[model samples]
Target: MTSRAVPPATAAVPVQDASLGAAVRLVRVSKTFPIAEGRALTAVDAVDLELAPGSLTALVGPSGSGKSTLLHLVGAIERADSGSLTVDGLDLVTANRRALTGYRRGVGFVFQRFHLLPALTALDNVLAPVLPDRRPGFDRVERARELFDAVGLAGREAALPSRLSGGQQQRVAIARALINRPRLLLADEPTGNLDSRTGRDVLDLLLDLRTRHPMTVVLSTHDPAIADMADHKVTLLDGRLASSSAPSAD
Candidate 1:
């Protein structure tokens, strides 16, 4: 089913618990895209949100809902039009590109397209994030293998994206996303391309990874099923918050 078909009520916003600490924070944030005549198209309005350390938060809304825009703001890929955003205490909205690159070393991303390299094997693709530049530690390949195994792609490590199933490719993307051992992970429509069963498996794997890796994860999906898995759900209505119900919306 397309993401739009699911029951949005299944996932609610997260409740704040001070124990986990704040992994990400946004206050009075807004984003606008410039149009002709120098007018602005508002994508996100003044919004405040947070992700607790080692928690899972889902940003849910339909297309053009600013869900992805919010995720990008946390990922440091794009700056907010105004206000402040912090990831693990690092100010991102005002950080320079060079600093953002350093900040990205602690942030991971999983795109809906499964941005894997077709020419390389799963292991190599995961390793690409940590090369002669990012990770200077010895045994990075071993680390990659560990991540591949963690994502349940052990024997398939040598397989190329073309040689793998869509779910497998997405798993490889997940593994690649973790290569940096980031404290915060942002995924845009992670299960959009998978069948229901495969998508469930992928979601399960993501939960397992979050538990094992102990990182804050924020994923934006048009799918409520994807959102339902999070400990926190941030819903957007017309680029504004519908609600935030966490801890237990139950």
Candidate 2:
């Protein structure tokens, strides 16, 4: 599908007995794809990472450095070829279909391209994720409205993607990602398409959402300035880890 589809919601919404974030860990993870002539291209080399609950980590690297692949592995869009990965104590690498489904429902993803449906309004786009199963008490529409408001798009719910500016469209995308109350958010260069000022605004929105929801966030970026804002910074080179640093008190 060109547009992102919501994962099946067979699992119940996670209870807030604790915080909204989930711990993620990776040990010697790697992924490779077969190319022409039967040779393989390693997208992610054996790498280890650990993300504490409710923390923000920035993945910084150049193009083709495996930043996106790392996020994809954690989001379960792509599987690791070897090693282990766990999120919130669930073994992702060996998770059964049902368990993986449940895990996906608790995670949200945003990309450089605001994958909003051109035909759908902002509110409709936000509500798209919950459309598959409209159980009672879900309040899908109400939650979408609230998210739009939360992202500063309250009065623009009826606006179409074509009618909204780049930043506004990105805001709608952010609202859509939050509709499921995901505990882990994966973003791949979410601000890459925006101007500097607007990118900063979108970055601020993401940081603000982190504080409001206390969810673990991992975003890939090429901008050092943006990476500096994160609580942790991880750099990749040639599908391998170059450096990992704690958050700086700037």
Top TM-score hit: 2
Candidate 2 stretches with Cα past 4 Å from truth are 1-20, 131-136, 248-250
TM-score of each: 0.87, 0.89
Measured by lDDT, the strongest candidate is 2
User: Per-residue lDDT tens digits of candidate 2, residues 80-176?
Assistant: 9998998988878888888888888888999899999999888988888774765867777778888888899888999899999999998999888
lDDT of every model, 2 decimals: 0.83, 0.88
Writing each residue's lDDT as its tens digit, candidate 1 over 52-154 gives 7778888887788898888888777788978888876678878889999888787889999898988998888998888475645667888888987898888
- Clash totals for all models, in order? 7, 0
